[model samples]
Target chain A: MIVSNMSKDELMKDIMAHDFKLYDLQLYLNTHPSDENALCMYQNLVNDTDELKDEYEEKYGPLTACSAAGDCEWKWIKNPWPWDKGGN
Target chain B: MWEYEKKLQYPINIKKPDPQMAKFIISQYGGPDGELAASLRYLSQKFSMPTEITKATLNDIGTEELAHLEMVGTLVSQLTKGVSPEEIKAAGLGDYYTDHGISVYPQSAAGNPFTAAYIQVKGDPRTDLYEDMAAEQKARSTYEYLIDLADDPDVIDVLKYLRQREVVHFQRFGEALRTVEEKLADKKFYMNNMINQPNKDCGCNKPKTKDCGCNKQ
Candidate 1:
Protein backbone atom coordinates (compact mmCIF):
# COMPACT_ATOMS: atom_id res chain seq x y z
CA MET A 1 0.00 0.00 0.00
CA ILE A 2 1.12 3.51 -0.72
CA VAL A 3 2.48 5.15 2.47
CA SER A 4 2.87 8.71 1.17
CA ASN A 5 0.02 11.10 0.50
CA MET A 6 -0.42 12.53 -2.99
CA SER A 7 -2.87 15.26 -3.92
CA LYS A 8 -6.11 14.10 -5.50
CA ASP A 9 -5.43 15.73 -8.86
CA GLU A 10 -1.81 14.63 -8.85
CA LEU A 11 -2.78 11.09 -8.02
CA MET A 12 -5.51 11.05 -10.69
CA LYS A 13 -3.07 12.35 -13.28
CA ASP A 14 -0.69 9.58 -12.38
CA ILE A 15 -3.50 7.09 -12.69
CA MET A 16 -4.34 8.31 -16.17
CA ALA A 17 -0.73 8.14 -17.22
CA HIS A 18 -0.29 4.65 -15.85
CA ASP A 19 -3.57 3.60 -17.44
CA PHE A 20 -2.28 4.69 -20.84
CA LYS A 21 1.07 2.99 -20.29
CA LEU A 22 -0.46 -0.24 -19.14
CA TYR A 23 -2.89 -0.25 -22.04
CA ASP A 24 -0.05 0.38 -24.48
CA LEU A 25 2.00 -2.39 -22.97
CA GLN A 26 -0.95 -4.76 -23.13
CA LEU A 27 -1.57 -4.01 -26.81
CA TYR A 28 2.09 -4.39 -27.65
CA LEU A 29 2.29 -7.73 -25.94
CA ASN A 30 -0.70 -9.10 -27.88
CA THR A 31 0.96 -8.96 -31.29
CA HIS A 32 4.57 -9.25 -30.22
CA PRO A 33 3.37 -12.28 -28.25
CA SER A 34 6.27 -12.18 -25.78
CA ASP A 35 8.43 -9.46 -24.26
CA GLU A 36 9.80 -10.25 -20.84
CA ASN A 37 10.89 -6.68 -20.31
CA ALA A 38 7.42 -5.34 -20.96
CA LEU A 39 5.94 -7.98 -18.69
CA CYS A 40 8.33 -7.09 -15.88
CA MET A 41 7.72 -3.40 -16.35
CA TYR A 42 3.97 -4.03 -16.35
CA GLN A 43 4.23 -6.08 -13.17
CA ASN A 44 6.29 -3.43 -11.40
CA LEU A 45 3.80 -0.76 -12.36
CA VAL A 46 0.90 -2.84 -11.13
CA ASN A 47 2.56 -3.51 -7.78
CA ASP A 48 3.54 0.10 -7.24
CA THR A 49 0.04 1.17 -8.28
CA ASP A 50 -1.58 -0.95 -5.60
CA GLU A 51 0.46 0.91 -3.01
CA LEU A 52 -0.64 4.25 -4.44
CA LYS A 53 -4.27 3.16 -4.27
CA ASP A 54 -4.02 2.25 -0.62
CA GLU A 55 -2.48 5.60 0.15
CA TYR A 56 -5.32 7.36 -1.68
CA GLU A 57 -8.09 5.51 0.15
CA GLU A 58 -6.49 6.17 3.52
CA LYS A 59 -6.10 9.89 2.87
CA TYR A 60 -9.47 10.61 1.31
CA GLY A 61 -12.82 9.33 2.48
CA PRO A 62 -13.87 6.04 0.94
CA LEU A 63 -13.68 6.42 -2.85
CA THR A 64 -17.32 5.47 -2.79
CA ALA A 65 -19.40 6.88 0.04
CA CYS A 66 -19.91 3.33 1.37
CA SER A 67 -18.09 1.72 4.27
CA ALA A 68 -14.85 -0.23 3.68
CA ALA A 69 -14.76 -1.97 7.00
CA GLY A 70 -14.83 -5.30 5.01
CA ASP A 71 -17.74 -6.69 7.00
CA CYS A 72 -20.42 -5.00 4.94
CA GLU A 73 -23.29 -6.76 3.19
CA TRP A 74 -22.57 -5.05 -0.11
CA LYS A 75 -18.87 -4.48 -0.63
CA TRP A 76 -19.25 -2.92 -4.08
CA ILE A 77 -20.83 0.17 -2.54
CA LYS A 78 -17.51 0.65 -0.82
CA ASN A 79 -15.93 1.11 -4.20
CA PRO A 80 -13.90 4.28 -4.42
CA TRP A 81 -15.00 7.15 -6.59
CA PRO A 82 -13.93 7.13 -10.22
CA TRP A 83 -11.67 10.10 -9.63
CA ASP A 84 -10.01 8.02 -7.00
CA LYS A 85 -6.77 6.36 -8.09
CA GLY A 86 -8.46 3.06 -7.35
CA GLY A 87 -10.74 3.66 -10.29
CA ASN A 88 -7.72 3.79 -12.55
CA MET B 1 -4.03 0.58 -10.88
CA TRP B 2 -4.46 4.29 -10.59
CA GLU B 3 -5.26 6.51 -7.61
CA TYR B 4 -7.63 9.43 -7.82
CA GLU B 5 -10.14 11.24 -5.61
CA LYS B 6 -13.77 10.77 -6.67
CA LYS B 7 -14.96 14.32 -6.11
CA LEU B 8 -12.73 15.64 -8.87
CA GLN B 9 -13.89 13.36 -11.68
CA TYR B 10 -17.14 15.20 -12.25
CA PRO B 11 -16.24 18.78 -11.38
CA ILE B 12 -18.62 20.60 -13.67
CA ASN B 13 -21.69 21.64 -11.72
CA ILE B 14 -24.76 20.76 -13.73
CA LYS B 15 -27.76 22.90 -12.88
CA LYS B 16 -31.36 21.74 -12.77
CA PRO B 17 -32.84 20.13 -15.87
CA ASP B 18 -34.23 21.69 -19.04
CA PRO B 19 -36.96 19.39 -20.30
CA GLN B 20 -37.00 20.60 -23.90
CA MET B 21 -33.37 19.72 -24.61
CA ALA B 22 -33.61 16.57 -22.56
CA LYS B 23 -35.96 14.92 -25.06
CA PHE B 24 -33.52 15.22 -27.94
CA ILE B 25 -30.47 14.35 -25.85
CA ILE B 26 -32.12 11.20 -24.56
CA SER B 27 -31.90 9.90 -28.09
CA GLN B 28 -28.15 9.88 -27.69
CA TYR B 29 -28.65 7.95 -24.50
CA GLY B 30 -30.50 5.28 -26.47
CA GLY B 31 -29.58 6.16 -30.04
CA PRO B 32 -27.96 3.69 -32.39
CA ASP B 33 -24.69 5.58 -32.34
CA GLY B 34 -25.10 7.00 -28.85
CA GLU B 35 -23.03 6.79 -25.66
CA LEU B 36 -24.58 3.53 -24.50
CA ALA B 37 -23.55 1.78 -27.67
CA ALA B 38 -20.11 3.34 -27.59
CA SER B 39 -19.57 2.19 -24.04
CA LEU B 40 -20.83 -1.34 -24.57
CA ARG B 41 -19.12 -1.64 -27.93
CA TYR B 42 -15.66 -0.76 -26.70
CA LEU B 43 -15.95 -2.52 -23.36
CA SER B 44 -17.12 -5.78 -24.96
CA GLN B 45 -14.37 -5.84 -27.57
CA LYS B 46 -11.56 -5.27 -25.09
CA PHE B 47 -11.44 -8.88 -24.05
CA SER B 48 -10.64 -10.19 -27.53
CA MET B 49 -7.79 -7.74 -28.10
CA PRO B 50 -4.48 -9.55 -28.55
CA THR B 51 -1.98 -7.32 -26.79
CA GLU B 52 -1.68 -6.04 -23.28
CA ILE B 53 -1.34 -2.46 -24.49
CA THR B 54 -4.42 -2.80 -26.66
CA LYS B 55 -6.36 -4.35 -23.82
CA ALA B 56 -5.29 -1.59 -21.47
CA THR B 57 -6.14 1.07 -24.03
CA LEU B 58 -9.46 -0.61 -24.63
CA ASN B 59 -10.14 -0.73 -20.92
CA ASP B 60 -9.33 2.93 -20.38
CA ILE B 61 -11.15 4.14 -23.45
CA GLY B 62 -14.03 1.77 -22.84
CA THR B 63 -14.25 2.90 -19.24
CA GLU B 64 -14.22 6.52 -20.32
CA GLU B 65 -17.03 5.80 -22.74
CA LEU B 66 -18.96 4.22 -19.90
CA ALA B 67 -18.58 7.47 -17.98
CA HIS B 68 -19.93 9.31 -20.97
CA LEU B 69 -22.87 6.93 -21.02
CA GLU B 70 -23.52 7.70 -17.38
CA MET B 71 -23.41 11.40 -18.10
CA VAL B 72 -26.04 10.95 -20.76
CA GLY B 73 -28.14 8.94 -18.34
CA THR B 74 -27.75 11.64 -15.73
CA LEU B 75 -28.91 14.24 -18.20
CA VAL B 76 -31.91 12.13 -19.08
CA SER B 77 -32.77 11.52 -15.46
CA GLN B 78 -32.52 15.20 -14.59
CA LEU B 79 -34.65 16.17 -17.56
CA THR B 80 -37.34 13.73 -16.59
CA LYS B 81 -37.44 14.73 -12.96
CA GLY B 82 -40.85 15.81 -11.63
CA VAL B 83 -42.33 14.94 -15.01
CA SER B 84 -45.94 13.79 -14.93
CA PRO B 85 -47.45 11.21 -17.24
CA GLU B 86 -49.27 13.97 -19.10
CA GLU B 87 -46.10 16.06 -19.53
CA ILE B 88 -44.19 13.01 -20.63
CA LYS B 89 -46.83 12.23 -23.23
CA ALA B 90 -46.72 15.81 -24.37
CA ALA B 91 -42.98 15.53 -24.83
CA GLY B 92 -43.34 12.16 -26.66
CA LEU B 93 -41.56 10.53 -23.74
CA GLY B 94 -44.47 8.37 -22.63
CA ASP B 95 -43.45 5.51 -24.89
CA TYR B 96 -39.91 5.76 -23.63
CA TYR B 97 -41.03 5.70 -20.02
CA THR B 98 -43.46 2.89 -20.65
CA ASP B 99 -40.67 0.60 -21.81
CA HIS B 100 -37.82 1.88 -19.67
CA GLY B 101 -39.94 3.14 -16.78
CA ILE B 102 -37.72 6.16 -16.12
CA SER B 103 -34.78 3.82 -15.93
CA VAL B 104 -31.81 4.51 -18.17
CA TYR B 105 -31.40 1.86 -20.84
CA PRO B 106 -29.08 1.06 -23.75
CA GLN B 107 -31.65 1.49 -26.47
CA SER B 108 -31.62 4.08 -29.21
CA ALA B 109 -33.80 7.14 -28.67
CA ALA B 110 -35.91 5.95 -31.58
CA GLY B 111 -37.04 3.14 -29.28
CA ASN B 112 -34.69 0.60 -30.86
CA PRO B 113 -32.95 -1.10 -27.95
CA PHE B 114 -29.32 -2.24 -27.52
CA THR B 115 -28.05 -4.93 -29.83
CA ALA B 116 -24.79 -6.85 -29.78
CA ALA B 117 -24.30 -5.71 -33.34
CA TYR B 118 -23.05 -2.41 -31.92
CA ILE B 119 -19.72 -4.01 -30.98
CA GLN B 120 -17.26 -5.99 -33.08
CA VAL B 121 -15.03 -8.66 -31.56
CA LYS B 122 -12.76 -9.48 -34.45
CA GLY B 123 -9.72 -11.36 -33.23
CA ASP B 124 -7.67 -9.44 -35.78
CA PRO B 125 -6.23 -6.43 -34.03
CA ARG B 126 -5.92 -4.42 -37.24
CA THR B 127 -9.55 -4.67 -38.21
CA ASP B 128 -10.85 -4.11 -34.71
CA LEU B 129 -8.65 -1.07 -34.10
CA TYR B 130 -9.68 0.49 -37.38
CA GLU B 131 -13.32 -0.03 -36.48
CA ASP B 132 -12.66 1.66 -33.15
CA MET B 133 -11.17 4.65 -34.97
CA ALA B 134 -14.22 4.93 -37.18
CA ALA B 135 -16.55 4.62 -34.21
CA GLU B 136 -14.85 7.56 -32.53
CA GLN B 137 -15.27 9.70 -35.63
CA LYS B 138 -18.93 8.80 -35.89
CA ALA B 139 -19.51 9.77 -32.27
CA ARG B 140 -17.60 13.01 -32.73
CA SER B 141 -19.76 14.00 -35.68
CA THR B 142 -22.92 13.17 -33.77
CA TYR B 143 -21.85 15.42 -30.92
CA GLU B 144 -21.11 18.20 -33.38
CA TYR B 145 -24.60 17.86 -34.79
CA LEU B 146 -26.17 17.73 -31.34
CA ILE B 147 -24.36 20.90 -30.37
CA ASP B 148 -25.60 22.54 -33.52
CA LEU B 149 -29.20 21.54 -32.84
CA ALA B 150 -29.33 22.61 -29.15
CA ASP B 151 -28.86 26.13 -27.73
CA ASP B 152 -29.06 25.58 -23.97
CA PRO B 153 -25.85 26.30 -22.06
CA ASP B 154 -26.02 23.25 -19.83
CA VAL B 155 -26.71 20.98 -22.78
CA ILE B 156 -23.90 22.62 -24.69
CA ASP B 157 -21.51 22.14 -21.81
CA VAL B 158 -22.25 18.45 -21.59
CA LEU B 159 -22.13 18.10 -25.36
CA LYS B 160 -18.77 19.83 -25.46
CA TYR B 161 -17.40 17.50 -22.83
CA LEU B 162 -18.56 14.46 -24.79
CA ARG B 163 -17.19 15.91 -28.04
CA GLN B 164 -13.72 16.42 -26.57
CA ARG B 165 -13.64 12.80 -25.52
CA GLU B 166 -14.30 11.74 -29.12
CA VAL B 167 -11.21 13.63 -30.26
CA VAL B 168 -9.16 12.06 -27.50
CA HIS B 169 -10.43 8.60 -28.35
CA PHE B 170 -9.61 9.18 -31.99
CA GLN B 171 -6.05 10.09 -31.07
CA ARG B 172 -5.71 7.05 -28.84
CA PHE B 173 -7.06 4.78 -31.61
CA GLY B 174 -4.54 6.28 -34.01
CA GLU B 175 -1.78 5.56 -31.53
CA ALA B 176 -3.13 2.07 -31.10
CA LEU B 177 -2.94 1.54 -34.87
CA ARG B 178 0.67 2.65 -34.97
CA THR B 179 1.48 0.47 -31.99
CA VAL B 180 -0.01 -2.52 -33.80
CA GLU B 181 1.88 -1.71 -36.99
CA GLU B 182 5.19 -1.28 -35.18
CA LYS B 183 4.81 -4.82 -33.84
CA LEU B 184 4.58 -6.36 -37.29
CA ALA B 185 7.73 -7.84 -38.82
CA ASP B 186 9.24 -5.68 -41.58
CA LYS B 187 8.59 -8.40 -44.15
CA LYS B 188 5.07 -8.99 -42.91
CA PHE B 189 4.42 -5.26 -42.71
CA TYR B 190 5.33 -4.38 -46.29
CA MET B 191 5.63 -7.57 -48.33
CA ASN B 192 2.15 -8.85 -47.68
CA ASN B 193 -0.95 -6.69 -47.99
CA MET B 194 -2.25 -8.42 -44.90
CA ILE B 195 -4.27 -5.41 -43.88
CA ASN B 196 -6.38 -5.63 -47.02
CA GLN B 197 -6.74 -9.38 -46.87
CA PRO B 198 -9.83 -10.75 -45.21
CA ASN B 199 -9.27 -10.65 -41.46
CA LYS B 200 -10.26 -13.84 -39.71
CA ASP B 201 -12.46 -13.55 -36.64
CA CYS B 202 -10.20 -13.88 -33.64
CA GLY B 203 -13.12 -14.75 -31.41
CA CYS B 204 -13.90 -17.86 -33.41
CA ASN B 205 -11.72 -19.75 -35.91
CA LYS B 206 -14.25 -19.03 -38.66
CA PRO B 207 -12.84 -16.61 -41.24
CA LYS B 208 -14.54 -13.23 -41.18
CA THR B 209 -16.18 -12.28 -44.44
CA LYS B 210 -16.97 -8.77 -45.70
CA ASP B 211 -18.66 -7.68 -42.47
CA CYS B 212 -17.37 -8.46 -38.99
CA GLY B 213 -21.01 -9.34 -38.04
CA CYS B 214 -21.13 -6.18 -35.95
CA ASN B 215 -23.82 -3.50 -36.10
CA LYS B 216 -24.72 -2.11 -39.49
CA GLN B 217 -22.66 0.88 -40.47
Candidate 2:
Protein backbone atom coordinates (compact mmCIF):
# COMPACT_ATOMS: atom_id res chain seq x y z
CA MET A 1 0.00 0.00 0.00
CA ILE A 2 1.32 3.46 -0.88
CA VAL A 3 1.24 6.21 1.70
CA SER A 4 -0.43 9.27 0.18
CA ASN A 5 2.05 11.59 1.92
CA MET A 6 5.15 9.87 0.64
CA SER A 7 7.48 11.85 -1.63
CA LYS A 8 8.16 10.86 -5.19
CA ASP A 9 11.59 9.55 -4.25
CA GLU A 10 10.17 7.39 -1.48
CA LEU A 11 7.47 5.97 -3.72
CA MET A 12 10.07 5.25 -6.35
CA LYS A 13 12.20 3.44 -3.80
CA ASP A 14 9.19 1.34 -2.88
CA ILE A 15 8.61 0.48 -6.51
CA MET A 16 12.25 -0.28 -7.14
CA ALA A 17 12.39 -2.52 -4.07
CA HIS A 18 9.36 -4.45 -5.27
CA ASP A 19 10.70 -4.69 -8.80
CA PHE A 20 14.12 -5.87 -7.62
CA LYS A 21 12.49 -8.67 -5.62
CA LEU A 22 10.32 -9.60 -8.59
CA TYR A 23 13.20 -9.57 -11.05
CA ASP A 24 15.33 -11.78 -8.83
CA LEU A 25 12.49 -14.22 -8.35
CA GLN A 26 11.85 -14.22 -12.09
CA LEU A 27 15.43 -15.20 -12.79
CA TYR A 28 15.17 -17.91 -10.14
CA LEU A 29 11.91 -19.26 -11.57
CA ASN A 30 13.40 -19.35 -15.04
CA THR A 31 15.33 -22.44 -13.98
CA HIS A 32 13.35 -23.62 -10.95
CA PRO A 33 9.94 -23.34 -12.46
CA SER A 34 8.42 -25.98 -10.17
CA ASP A 35 9.21 -24.13 -6.95
CA GLU A 36 5.76 -23.43 -5.53
CA ASN A 37 7.00 -21.11 -2.78
CA ALA A 38 8.96 -18.92 -5.16
CA LEU A 39 6.09 -18.95 -7.63
CA CYS A 40 3.69 -17.73 -4.95
CA MET A 41 6.00 -14.91 -3.96
CA TYR A 42 6.51 -14.01 -7.60
CA GLN A 43 2.76 -13.80 -8.21
CA ASN A 44 2.24 -11.63 -5.16
CA LEU A 45 4.99 -9.24 -6.23
CA VAL A 46 3.55 -9.09 -9.73
CA ASN A 47 0.22 -7.81 -8.40
CA ASP A 48 1.82 -5.43 -5.91
CA THR A 49 4.24 -4.01 -8.45
CA ASP A 50 1.53 -3.49 -11.03
CA GLU A 51 -0.50 -1.52 -8.51
CA LEU A 52 2.55 0.46 -7.47
CA LYS A 53 3.45 1.22 -11.10
CA ASP A 54 -0.05 2.48 -11.81
CA GLU A 55 0.12 4.81 -8.83
CA TYR A 56 3.57 6.02 -9.83
CA GLU A 57 2.63 6.72 -13.41
CA GLU A 58 -0.61 8.38 -12.39
CA LYS A 59 1.07 10.86 -10.06
CA TYR A 60 4.65 11.27 -11.27
CA GLY A 61 4.09 11.26 -15.02
CA PRO A 62 4.25 8.41 -17.49
CA LEU A 63 6.85 5.74 -16.82
CA THR A 64 6.31 4.26 -20.26
CA ALA A 65 5.95 6.26 -23.47
CA CYS A 66 2.37 5.07 -23.98
CA SER A 67 1.20 5.80 -20.42
CA ALA A 68 -1.80 8.05 -19.82
CA ALA A 69 -1.33 11.77 -20.06
CA GLY A 70 -4.50 13.52 -18.89
CA ASP A 71 -5.53 16.05 -21.57
CA CYS A 72 -4.46 16.18 -25.21
CA GLU A 73 -0.87 17.34 -24.76
CA TRP A 74 2.26 15.21 -24.39
CA LYS A 75 3.35 15.12 -20.73
CA TRP A 76 5.48 12.01 -21.06
CA ILE A 77 8.07 14.03 -22.91
CA LYS A 78 7.76 16.80 -20.35
CA ASN A 79 8.34 14.48 -17.39
CA PRO A 80 11.90 14.49 -16.19
CA TRP A 81 13.98 11.96 -18.02
CA PRO A 82 15.94 9.47 -15.90
CA TRP A 83 19.22 11.22 -16.58
CA ASP A 84 17.96 14.52 -15.23
CA LYS A 85 19.29 15.35 -11.79
CA GLY A 86 17.13 13.52 -9.19
CA GLY A 87 14.68 12.82 -12.02
CA ASN A 88 13.95 9.25 -10.92
CA MET B 1 9.08 -5.60 -29.35
CA TRP B 2 10.55 -3.18 -26.83
CA GLU B 3 8.86 -0.49 -24.77
CA TYR B 4 10.72 2.49 -23.40
CA GLU B 5 10.63 3.21 -19.66
CA LYS B 6 11.45 6.86 -18.97
CA LYS B 7 12.53 6.17 -15.42
CA LEU B 8 15.60 4.28 -14.33
CA GLN B 9 15.35 0.77 -12.87
CA TYR B 10 17.26 2.12 -9.90
CA PRO B 11 17.49 5.74 -8.88
CA ILE B 12 20.90 7.41 -9.05
CA ASN B 13 21.53 10.76 -7.40
CA ILE B 14 25.23 11.52 -7.54
CA LYS B 15 25.60 14.80 -5.65
CA LYS B 16 29.17 15.51 -6.68
CA PRO B 17 30.26 16.19 -10.25
CA ASP B 18 33.49 14.29 -10.66
CA PRO B 19 34.59 14.27 -14.25
CA GLN B 20 37.50 12.01 -13.30
CA MET B 21 35.17 9.36 -11.99
CA ALA B 22 32.94 9.71 -15.01
CA LYS B 23 35.89 8.90 -17.23
CA PHE B 24 36.58 5.65 -15.38
CA ILE B 25 32.92 4.62 -15.07
CA ILE B 26 32.16 5.25 -18.73
CA SER B 27 34.22 2.13 -19.38
CA GLN B 28 31.30 0.03 -18.20
CA TYR B 29 28.97 1.92 -20.52
CA GLY B 30 30.84 0.84 -23.67
CA GLY B 31 34.07 -0.89 -22.76
CA PRO B 32 35.08 -4.44 -23.70
CA ASP B 33 33.36 -6.06 -20.71
CA GLY B 34 30.66 -3.39 -20.42
CA GLU B 35 26.89 -3.62 -20.04
CA LEU B 36 26.33 -2.86 -23.73
CA ALA B 37 28.38 -5.87 -24.73
CA ALA B 38 26.67 -8.01 -22.13
CA SER B 39 23.20 -7.07 -23.38
CA LEU B 40 24.10 -7.49 -27.03
CA ARG B 41 25.89 -10.78 -26.47
CA TYR B 42 22.91 -12.52 -24.87
CA LEU B 43 20.15 -10.88 -26.93
CA SER B 44 21.96 -11.83 -30.11
CA GLN B 45 22.36 -15.37 -28.80
CA LYS B 46 18.68 -15.84 -27.90
CA PHE B 47 17.48 -16.81 -31.38
CA SER B 48 20.02 -19.61 -31.58
CA MET B 49 19.37 -20.99 -28.10
CA PRO B 50 18.66 -24.71 -28.07
CA THR B 51 15.79 -24.79 -25.54
CA GLU B 52 12.91 -22.66 -24.31
CA ILE B 53 14.46 -22.26 -20.87
CA THR B 54 17.79 -21.13 -22.29
CA LYS B 55 16.13 -18.70 -24.64
CA ALA B 56 14.00 -17.09 -21.93
CA THR B 57 16.89 -16.87 -19.52
CA LEU B 58 19.10 -15.16 -22.08
CA ASN B 59 16.35 -12.79 -23.12
CA ASP B 60 15.52 -11.70 -19.57
CA ILE B 61 19.13 -11.32 -18.54
CA GLY B 62 19.87 -9.41 -21.73
CA THR B 63 17.00 -7.04 -21.05
CA GLU B 64 18.19 -6.49 -17.51
CA GLU B 65 21.64 -5.73 -18.81
CA LEU B 66 20.10 -2.93 -20.81
CA ALA B 67 18.87 -1.51 -17.50
CA HIS B 68 22.34 -1.80 -16.14
CA LEU B 69 23.54 0.07 -19.20
CA GLU B 70 21.13 2.85 -18.34
CA MET B 71 22.45 2.97 -14.81
CA VAL B 72 25.98 3.26 -16.11
CA GLY B 73 24.93 5.99 -18.48
CA THR B 74 23.20 7.87 -15.69
CA LEU B 75 26.22 7.53 -13.48
CA VAL B 76 28.38 8.97 -16.20
CA SER B 77 25.91 11.66 -17.08
CA GLN B 78 25.40 12.75 -13.51
CA LEU B 79 29.09 12.75 -12.80
CA THR B 80 29.87 14.89 -15.80
CA LYS B 81 27.00 17.34 -15.42
CA GLY B 82 28.22 20.92 -14.98
CA VAL B 83 31.88 19.89 -15.14
CA SER B 84 34.16 22.66 -16.36
CA PRO B 85 36.55 22.25 -19.27
CA GLU B 86 39.49 22.76 -16.94
CA GLU B 87 38.23 19.95 -14.71
CA ILE B 88 37.74 17.77 -17.77
CA LYS B 89 41.32 18.36 -18.84
CA ALA B 90 42.58 17.65 -15.34
CA ALA B 91 40.56 14.40 -15.39
CA GLY B 92 42.42 13.46 -18.56
CA LEU B 93 39.08 13.46 -20.41
CA GLY B 94 40.41 16.16 -22.76
CA ASP B 95 40.35 13.91 -25.82
CA TYR B 96 36.83 12.79 -24.95
CA TYR B 97 35.64 16.38 -24.39
CA THR B 98 36.99 17.45 -27.77
CA ASP B 99 34.72 14.93 -29.44
CA HIS B 100 31.63 15.02 -27.23
CA GLY B 101 31.52 18.04 -24.86
CA ILE B 102 29.77 16.91 -21.65
CA SER B 103 27.59 14.33 -23.40
CA VAL B 104 27.89 10.66 -22.53
CA TYR B 105 29.47 8.64 -25.33
CA PRO B 106 30.11 4.92 -25.65
CA GLN B 107 33.87 4.61 -25.38
CA SER B 108 36.50 3.25 -23.07
CA ALA B 109 38.58 5.22 -20.55
CA ALA B 110 41.60 4.64 -22.74
CA GLY B 111 39.76 6.17 -25.74
CA ASN B 112 38.73 3.00 -27.63
CA PRO B 113 35.28 3.28 -29.18
CA PHE B 114 32.81 0.47 -28.53
CA THR B 115 33.03 -2.31 -31.13
CA ALA B 116 31.01 -5.46 -31.81
CA ALA B 117 34.25 -7.38 -31.46
CA TYR B 118 33.86 -6.98 -27.69
CA ILE B 119 31.30 -9.78 -27.51
CA GLN B 120 31.18 -13.35 -28.84
CA VAL B 121 27.98 -15.13 -29.96
CA LYS B 122 28.86 -18.73 -30.77
CA GLY B 123 25.93 -20.69 -32.24
CA ASP B 124 26.71 -23.55 -29.87
CA PRO B 125 24.73 -23.19 -26.64
CA ARG B 126 27.32 -24.64 -24.29
CA THR B 127 30.08 -22.54 -25.74
CA ASP B 128 27.97 -19.39 -25.62
CA LEU B 129 26.85 -20.07 -22.04
CA TYR B 130 30.47 -20.47 -21.02
CA GLU B 131 31.21 -17.14 -22.60
CA ASP B 132 28.31 -15.55 -20.69
CA MET B 133 29.58 -16.94 -17.41
CA ALA B 134 33.00 -15.46 -18.10
CA ALA B 135 31.44 -12.16 -19.10
CA GLU B 136 29.59 -11.94 -15.78
CA GLN B 137 32.80 -12.52 -13.89
CA LYS B 138 34.58 -9.86 -15.87
CA ALA B 139 31.77 -7.40 -15.20
CA ARG B 140 31.80 -8.22 -11.51
CA SER B 141 35.52 -7.51 -11.38
CA THR B 142 35.05 -4.22 -13.18
CA TYR B 143 32.46 -3.19 -10.61
CA GLU B 144 34.79 -4.16 -7.80
CA TYR B 145 37.52 -2.02 -9.27
CA LEU B 146 35.16 0.87 -9.77
CA ILE B 147 33.92 0.58 -6.22
CA ASP B 148 37.48 0.57 -4.95
CA LEU B 149 38.26 3.75 -6.82
CA ALA B 150 35.03 5.52 -5.89
CA ASP B 151 35.28 8.04 -3.06
CA ASP B 152 31.72 9.22 -3.12
CA PRO B 153 29.55 7.23 -0.73
CA ASP B 154 26.52 7.70 -2.93
CA VAL B 155 28.33 6.42 -5.99
CA ILE B 156 29.75 3.48 -4.04
CA ASP B 157 26.30 2.43 -2.85
CA VAL B 158 25.00 2.19 -6.41
CA LEU B 159 28.13 0.41 -7.54
CA LYS B 160 27.71 -2.10 -4.73
CA TYR B 161 24.12 -2.75 -5.75
CA LEU B 162 25.20 -3.21 -9.36
CA ARG B 163 28.02 -5.52 -8.26
CA GLN B 164 25.69 -7.73 -6.27
CA ARG B 165 23.42 -7.89 -9.27
CA GLU B 166 26.35 -9.19 -11.30
CA VAL B 167 26.81 -11.93 -8.73
CA VAL B 168 23.14 -12.87 -8.89
CA HIS B 169 23.20 -12.83 -12.69
CA PHE B 170 26.26 -15.04 -12.66
CA GLN B 171 24.46 -17.55 -10.48
CA ARG B 172 21.39 -17.45 -12.70
CA PHE B 173 23.40 -17.83 -15.91
CA GLY B 174 25.25 -20.78 -14.42
CA GLU B 175 21.90 -22.32 -13.53
CA ALA B 176 20.64 -21.67 -17.07
CA LEU B 177 23.67 -23.43 -18.48
CA ARG B 178 22.88 -26.47 -16.39
CA THR B 179 19.24 -26.35 -17.39
CA VAL B 180 20.27 -26.35 -21.03
CA GLU B 181 22.55 -29.33 -20.46
CA GLU B 182 19.80 -31.34 -18.80
CA LYS B 183 17.33 -30.56 -21.57
CA LEU B 184 19.87 -31.55 -24.18
CA ALA B 185 20.24 -34.90 -22.46
CA ASP B 186 16.49 -35.54 -22.47
CA LYS B 187 15.34 -37.83 -25.26
CA LYS B 188 12.00 -36.03 -25.60
CA PHE B 189 13.66 -32.69 -26.23
CA TYR B 190 16.03 -34.28 -28.73
CA MET B 191 13.09 -35.78 -30.61
CA ASN B 192 11.16 -32.49 -30.66
CA ASN B 193 13.85 -31.00 -32.86
CA MET B 194 12.57 -33.01 -35.82
CA ILE B 195 9.49 -30.81 -35.83
CA ASN B 196 7.13 -29.87 -38.63
CA GLN B 197 6.24 -26.24 -39.06
CA PRO B 198 6.51 -24.39 -35.76
CA ASN B 199 2.83 -23.49 -36.10
CA LYS B 200 1.97 -27.19 -36.25
CA ASP B 201 2.92 -27.57 -32.54
CA CYS B 202 3.18 -31.26 -33.51
CA GLY B 203 2.77 -32.20 -29.82
CA CYS B 204 6.29 -33.44 -30.40
CA ASN B 205 7.01 -34.64 -26.86
CA LYS B 206 4.33 -37.37 -26.69
CA PRO B 207 5.48 -40.97 -26.63
CA LYS B 208 3.49 -41.61 -29.80
CA THR B 209 4.75 -38.39 -31.43
CA LYS B 210 7.84 -38.24 -33.64
CA ASP B 211 9.44 -36.07 -36.35
CA CYS B 212 8.11 -32.70 -35.19
CA GLY B 213 9.26 -29.02 -34.82
CA CYS B 214 10.88 -29.01 -38.26
CA ASN B 215 11.69 -26.19 -40.70
CA LYS B 216 8.30 -26.24 -42.42
CA GLN B 217 7.55 -22.78 -41.01
Best by DockQ: 2
lDDT of 1 by residue, A1-88 (tens): 5465567657755654565466556555544457789989988888776666566556644544343444444444544434222333
lDDT per residue (tens digit) for residues B106-190 in model 2: 9887879999999988899999999999999999999999999999998999898889988998898899899778877787623
Please give the CA lDDT of all the candidate structures.
Answer: 0.67, 0.88
TM-score of chain B of each: 0.76, 0.85
How much DockQ does model 1 earn?
0.17
Encode model 1's per-residue lDDT on B74-180: one tens digit a residue: 66666666667777777777887677666666666567777767767787888888988998898888888889877767668878877877887787778777877
Error of 2 at B184 (Å): 3.9
Stretches of candidate 1 above 4 Å error? A1-61, A65-67, A70-88, B1-8, B188-217
Give lDDT: candidate 1, residue B91: 76
> What DockQ does each listed candidate score?
0.17, 0.73
- Give the distance in Å from residue B3's predicted Cα in candidate 2 to where it truly belongs: 1.2
